[model samples]
Target: MMRLFIGGAVLVALAGCGETRDGNKPTGEATAKAAPAGWNAMDACATVGTPAVAAAMGKAVTGTALDPVSQPDGLRAGFSMCTFTLADGAKLTVLTREAADGDAYDAAVAAARKIGEEFGSPAVDVAGIGKAAMWTARPAALQVFLDDRRYATISLFGADFMPDGSEAARSAATAIARKLAS
Candidate 1:
């Protein structure tokens, strides 16, 4: 059951990276709002190296890539992702996006919930991370709605993975979100 949740979450997260039906990338204006005053969208990867992340992994983490992956055509400019490789070959990924408004955030939450329902997994409401967050049990993934205009996801990949409620993953996510919010 746990493996199924993790797998489903990973698939959903990956699905968000594909081109939209229109085959267009999102414009900067569409995803530009909600970034903290000093937040540099391009430097999102740097923020993943927080002590919280280190503490969560219980080992040193090395960043493998800091680049933008394919995004839904409607959100081309609104998405960014960073990945780090752990010593045991596990992976930690942080994905950020710019939403248009509350509607958009709501849509994202709904979509995530649907994914969980499809797989017979439940999405749990998580407190104190952002404006709102949904933790999917199957995939052990955390999606945070930082505000109407911004949100992020934290995911872990590898065998012997932690659940979405794991303290380490949650703490690391909170740390990264704080950096992005700043």
Candidate 2:
């Protein structure tokens, strides 16, 4: 399961490198939208280290410095990320993406779906996390599309990891989703 999960995540990350599965380029209009009104792209750093997330992990987690995403097109796309490392060297990454409108949001969802399909594990809808939420067990990742024209992905990685059904990752992701929604 861990191997499948890791493989799925790898496929997802690689899919982000270029055009969609249909070979269509993402239009500028879709990627040009701003983040929700109050969202600062930089806040992703703090979100990863929230007290709620620490509690869910059952251990103190230290966040790494914020890393700016550099896309090949140089479009900002309101993307930011940071990783929280646990005492056992396990890591969880928090990813924030701008989805100011339905077009952007839909595109993002499609991309996620394609990634899941590529890994032979299609995304399954998850209830109550956001406007729309999905989880791919093999990768043990959770993705939430909040009401604020923003979306987030929580990915788990480490030598010691929990199964997808475990509450730890889901709980932490939910806690972060609540923060993002607010």
Candidate 3:
């Protein structure tokens, strides 16, 4: 009887061990939980920036829902701002904000342009309309803007980037720009 009880307890423990824990593998549900479904890495960044700039501006620029990473150099400070998804399986990182004091903005812009140029993307595959852009080392894209009045420049860096819903990003930018203007 004693041997049978011990054997039964061991069997119960083994049975529980084989059970799958929540999110054991990269299944549809697990992937969905890991990241937003139907969304790529770039889309993750693009969807950042809130619509309520008028209210939120001037107080304090708090952190955002989308996780932001900052890379600061002597001449320029780059921030991964927007994130979005692409048709292809690539995660995009939208880098924005290159702040400087005097000629820092210009230097930042030059650095950014140089970085993009160095990417040396082959002929842009999209309809091959314009010159073939250079592809960055990582799967990424960039949108750069200079704010002369604010003396700050911003770059939208994308990873696994796509042009989906650019209008949405533009609208978000408008709000952010307005805030920055003030």
lDDT of each residue in 1-182, candidate 2, tens digit only = 44335434533543333233344544323434444455664566765455756776777776574665533233223566767777777877777665323344555566776655655667888777667888765466777776435567777776444543455666666667766766
In angstroms, give how far residue 2 of model 2 lies from its true place. Answer: 12
In model 2, what is the error at residue 114, expressed in angstroms? 2.6
Best by lDDT: 2
* lDDT per residue (tens digit) for residues 2-89 in model 1: 4335434533543443223344533222443445664443444655554546676676676567656444344333556677777777
| Residue 70 error, candidate 3, Å | 4.5
Compared with the true structure, all predictions reach lDDT values of 0.57, 0.59, 0.30
What lDDT, from 0 to 1, does candidate 2 have? Answer: 0.59
Candidate 1 Cα misplacement greater than 4 A, ranges: 1-34, 50-52, 69-77, 100-103, 162-175, 178-182
Candidate 3 C-alpha error for residue 87, in Å: 8.0
Evaluation by lDDT, superior candidate among 1 and 2: 2
User: Distance from true position, residue 66, model 3, in Å?
Assistant: 3.1
Q: Write the per-residue lDDT of candidate 3 for residues 1-182, one digit (tens) a residue.
A: 32223223222222222123343421112111122232232222342333342232222233333434444343333333443333332222233333222223333334434543443532111211111111222113323232410111122223312333243333443344333333
